[model samples]
Target chain A: MATLEIHDLHVSVEAENGPREILKGVDLTVKQGETHAIMGPNGSGKSTLAYSLAGHPKYTITGGTVTLDGEDVLAMSVDERARAGVFLAMQYPVEVPGVSVSNFLRTSATAIRGEAPKLRTWVKEVKGAMERLNMDPAFAERNVNEGFSGGEKKRHEILQLELLKPKIAILDETDSGLDVDALRQVSEGVNRVRETGEVGTLLITHYTRILRYIKPDFVHVFSGGRIVESGGAELADKLESEGYEAYQTKGGVTA
Target chain B: MADNTPAGSTTDGAIQVGGPQQPIDARVSAPASYDVADFPVPHGREEEWRFTPLERLRGLHDGTAVANGGGVKVEVSAPAGVTVETVGRDDARLGRSGKPVDRVAAQAYTSFEKASVVSIPKDAVLTEPVTISVHGEGGVAFGHQVIEVGAFAEAVVVLDHTGDTTLAANVEFLVGDGAKLTVVSVQDWDATAVHAAQHTALIGRDASFKSVIVTFGGDLVRLHPRVVYGAPGGEAELYGLYFTDKGQHQEHRLFVDHDTPHCRSNVAYKGALQGKDAHAVWIGDVLIRAEAEGTDTYELNRNLVLTDGARVDSVPNLEIETGEIVGAGHASATGRFDDEQLFYLMARGIPADEARRLVVRGFFAELVQQIGIPELEERLIAKIEAELEASVA
Candidate 1:
């Protein structure tokens, strides 16, 4: 079982003018087998929280304490955090030319598992995971994210999420460009991992559509770079109908 | 010396050497000749020698380096039906494909004592590749080699160069009508070696020619590979990969002349440079003449700069005299490592050095696959890994 605690997290990014704070003293905690959906409008600093937790150099953690199972996650490097079982399924997966999908997956598995996976079983495992996502077997040989459609890229991210089996998985806008069918397929993948009961998922999105498939244990209304309200699944239904306009008007948040 | 104009002369009054004064061809200014005097010594200002370090050539340009008998040892092994012979310079089959176009090549032609010739008989399809190993012992040496495939014959040849020496050589490939030939030339010389070589191939009617040039070693290595078609329907594919390390200079200049109608050609070269003073140069030139209608050609060059102080110069030139050609295109790009790419790989738990290795290896994987030899391909990949290890350590 793993636990992620983010207390008073303050993140800033360098803009043309100067350093601008994005995450303003946010607090959140996620335990293994728990699903947390961070609902927000545009520029609500939802993705900023995702990348900052992943240790992106662009986001500076001005003041925060992020710990994973009592380890200083904020002090660890991006790769070290990954090896420690923190996975981020990026919104726009980068295109790595000439690197095949099979090689990338195997290398990642080796890094996390501390040894290369058994070749025979690993091949079957990859083939099975890819088939579960309805991905073509030929996709394994193609370069990562190179020439892949938007839906295909999302499915690839979910495929990694299923295979890496990280303790804490952050899905950043995984449902942004996905269609209805792709959304259902991707959500099914997340739900399969959720059923494992050994992973904590932090699904960040602007729409409540994904929450319909993967029910969140808690829904947090993010506004002005911080979560202003927290409630049960009923809160999501409320926001879906009432929309984020109430929070923006109450917090005087622009966009 | 006064009568001979400098090779770099661009003045209107500068006279052409060893030939009657006439309008210079825009494509190639210098005329081809077997005589060393016909080509003047390059003074670093000439277009061809601008990117080269002439002082490191060890006298290959000025004709002062005498042939040291044991400088290089040549060994050739062919299958039973193939003919391999060491013939004198006066052999009638010598210089049949193309003449020396530069001073070093002309000097090599005038200086070499014995030439090695490998011939594949008509209608013969080789099951095994013919291997030629040139081991540089020491001192200065010049060499000439010819590989000819008979009509309808298909053969693959491997030319391997190793050891240390100051050497200039010329290689020719004569692909007969309807023949298919694949050549792999590897320059894995010692660190102190200096090498300059010209590789020319003349493709016959309806023939196919493919060449893979892999350069990794030597202090200063300049290779000029040229292709010319003898008849229409001939096809040529040239692929090259080079890894330049600290204080090394590697240059590859290619020319594909589509003088015949309905011919096709494609050239692709990729290189990686690391450490201080590591330099790489790629010049690709494709010329489609007026009579060569329906000609299809494309050339591409890409370079990966691994570290600071490494330099890459990539120039692609395509000249078409007639619009009746099928297509003509060229592309060149030199770039440092992409940060997002590194981040993407590292975000998956790969270390920084290992991620760099993966990206660089991926960059060259396409060209390395063109070698078509499993053992050689594996060895090249190993060499690339070793090169990466040096920097990572």
Candidate 2:
């Protein structure tokens, strides 16, 4: 079964002066068939944790061991880790002008699976996936993220998540730039993947709107580079009622 | 410094032309003045050929462009419903209505068949592109061609330059007003071929013309595509790509002129160079005239040098008078594979080589997609894949 394990991970980015730590000693684990949510205020290292896990060049890992089913995750290349079942739904999917969504999806699929899928089966699967997410088939032929509205880019990333069938998916603010309709469509896409029992979801965001659709089994309050508090899904509900102002004041400086 | 001296005459009364041969007596040649015979060799005497390289013409007849093993041959089979007219240099059909400039008095092989003119009638919309195939398997052959698209007509032309032998070809195009013409030229010559080609285009008012050249073959290939608008509302776009490897020299020189008011033109060319002696050159010149008010023009030339041995030279120029009657600008830059863009792709699950390929592919993929033709784009990708395979070999 697929599993994600992040242990004492410290992340930092290059600042004007020098390296400024963003994620400090953050630790979390989510086994297959479970969805976990990470919520925090701005600069609380939520997105940093997600990007570091995805192997973005900008974020450097100070110290940590990210494992997938006991495999050394940090040691794998970004694509290798992806092959090993890690997927990241980026906050801002880059607008690649000429690469169509269909081409990108097919390439990504071939990349993750190590070969091209049978045309009939793959076409059917892609069509079904789009229909389930309330996405039009025409969306597949459009250029990847080019000329796409904010919500469209986010949904497109989810479409990739559905097609690649990754075991572990880190949704980095999937709900940040979506209208109500787009938010529901994105959440539904995440839920459909969970329903298949083939993927695990790591929802990273500050909003509680998406949690209403893809309920998280556990909610972690990320304060500094580390998770300061962890609890049941009620914690997300609590944060939805009360803001992150107090959490930022409590241990934010140390973060 | 004699006031009585003619424009090109030296005090010796002999015209000293700065070309391959030494000064020729202007008096003996002036009155009769340049029969096509006078242009046995191309020198830098004429304005159009001022910046041209005379060294390239050193092997005119003596240094034959040897054909690849078994020899090379050229054949032109255009799509049906598209009429093809073959004209020989002696046919007098390829001559311009205006004064003839004996720049590179081209010699299209009789076996090479002077040139062919393809015509797409007015208002005729062609679904398939006209495929012109050139085969060079024997010795060397050079070709000259002229194409005309009638007003309100739409057509695509595919010029496939393939040679098992060496070849140098020149192509020229003229599009009538309000016609839409798309020209996709592919150069997949044998690596043994040394290719030097020139293409000129004149776009009439409201005419939409696009020229795309995919360079991959030949020991060395130099292509120049020039476009000048006839009047306001005319449009022209030039897109080019070249992938060169060691022992191969590929260069592209492009000129887009907004000669009339309200004309628009855009040009973008990207290339990748690899191997120990691979070289790529790009010169983009956009000239806007003072009277060409309210014209819009932009140009960009980008190059990618994949390895240490590869080299790229890029130059983007913009010439505009003090009058700012329109929007005009130009940009040019050469970059190796960006470590960050690569890392980003790799992080998303693409391997290093594949990542570089994808980014490089993505680098030019944008332009290929923007091209109105799809099959030619596939042909381009396939040609690049051949380069990849050869490099690996």
Candidate 3:
């Protein structure tokens, strides 16, 4: 089983004025087959934590310890983190103009799996995954995320999640901009991966709407770059009814 | 000191402007004279010669460059119904497609001993392509070649250049009515070679022509491609792809003159540069004359700068003299690798270097497919990977 442990993670970004801290001191852990929802308001460093774990160069790790099953994840480069089984479904997936989805998927699979997948079987696997995600088969030939709709982008991220089969996946705001039907389809894809019982899911979102589909085992209330409160699944119900208003006040657990 | 000389001449032009802007009239259209003596030697001041280093030309711009006996070794492979002949200068078909607009072109036209003419008969559609390979052994050389396709014929020509030489040559394409012709010119010379050439295409009524120019080797190379419509309903597609390495200068200047009604043209050129002093220049010019109503044209140039010191200059100009034209537009973009694109690929487990190579390959993939030759496309892709490998090494 794989476990991702992030302790006192402090990250900063180079803003126009100077280096400003985004994640002050955040702590979280995700074990195999578990789902942890990081709920936060806008600009609460939810995406920053995701990008930092993915080793994005734009996020500077000032003071932190990120380990994947006792191995130092902070020392690994972006691709190494991926190879070591840490996947990130970005909030904004970048558009790579000339790379087809099929080629990009195969290349990514080869890089992570350490060998090229057999062509015939790999094509079958991709077709099956795409069909489950409600994607057109012709979408494989389109450029990666180029001119894709909001719902399509979310579906593509989940498609990669299923195909790559990483040990730990941090889905950052995958629920946003998706319609009701698209949200259900994408959540179904994520649920399918979770059913394998070998991957940990870090579902990050602002609203608790997605929690209705893919139930989270642990709920963490994040504010000002740190987890202010942690509880069982009932906390999502509380956040759904009361919102983050209780966490916004200084040291208020009044709710 | 000449009384009729324009204001932008040599030192005066360089000192007065002191910038990248060119004088209005100095932007060369078609010149009136094709004689070698008619065009004056450039001092790196004119718009066309501004990016070119004059001394590196080896006297090709002036009349001093001569065709030594040790020059290019030309080989030709023709299909069953094709005719290959070397005609002398007095042939009536010479210069019918275009006149020499620059000093290098005029010098090449006046210096060549004889011109190689490859002709395809009317209504002949060959299954096999015509291949011409020009290998430079040594010394300086000048050449002139014309590939003529008769009415209703369809042909593809591959002109491959290899080895080292200081060469200046002119190539022409005459596509007859209802004919389709595709020409792929590859400049794969030795790293020390210098090459200058001008390509002209004359498109007949309802005819179609496509030119694919690929440049990789050579220390300095400059190519000028111009298209003129002989009748209405002509269509032309000019696609170019080049890889510029350290200390190499590769320039492509194109002009598509829409002088006939109902004619259309499209130009797209993509390039990648790596290492210090690697320079790539693209100049796209499209002019629609007053009488040419119903004209449609668009040009695009995209450059990917792979290293710090590599530079790219992209200029796209569209001149429309008719308000009745259908459409005219152009775009030019030069940039480094998109970091977000790299990060996205890497986050999916592709290594940094592999991710970079993929991005560059994708940048040129569209133009490579426009070539319409699968084997050459694969070879060009391999060449691109090899070039990227050297950069990392």
The whole-model lDDT of each prediction reads 0.88, 0.72, 0.88
- lDDT digits (tens) for residues A99-202 of candidate 3: 89999999999999999999999999999999999999999999899889999999999999999999999999999999999999999999999999999999
* Residue B307 of model 2, lDDT score: 60
| Model 3 ranges with Cα > 4 A deviation | A12-25, A41-44, A62-64, A118-121, A237-255, B1-26, B43-45, B62-71, B77-93, B120-128, B150-154, B177-180, B262-264, B293-298, B305-310, B321-336
Better of 2 and 3 by TM-score: 3
How much DockQ does model 2 earn?
0.25
Looking at candidate 1 chain A, the ten consecutive residues that score lowest on lDDT are: A246-255
Which of the two, 1 or 3, has more DockQ? 3
For B267-328, candidate 2 gives per-residue lDDT tens digits of 98878777776777777767666667787888877766666666665666566642655577
Model 2, position B192, has a per-residue lDDT of 72
The complex in candidate 1 yields a DockQ of 0.55
Q: Can you tell me which runs of candidate 2 are displaced by over 4 Å?
A: A14-18, A249-255, B1-197, B200-212, B217-221, B226-240, B244-251, B254-348, B355-380, B390-393
- Which candidate leads in TM-score? 3
lDDT of 2 by residue, A47-137 (tens): 9888888887788888888998999988877888888888989887775434567777777788888999889999998899888777789
lDDT of 1 by residue, A202-255 (tens): 999999999989999989999989999999889999999999989997755754
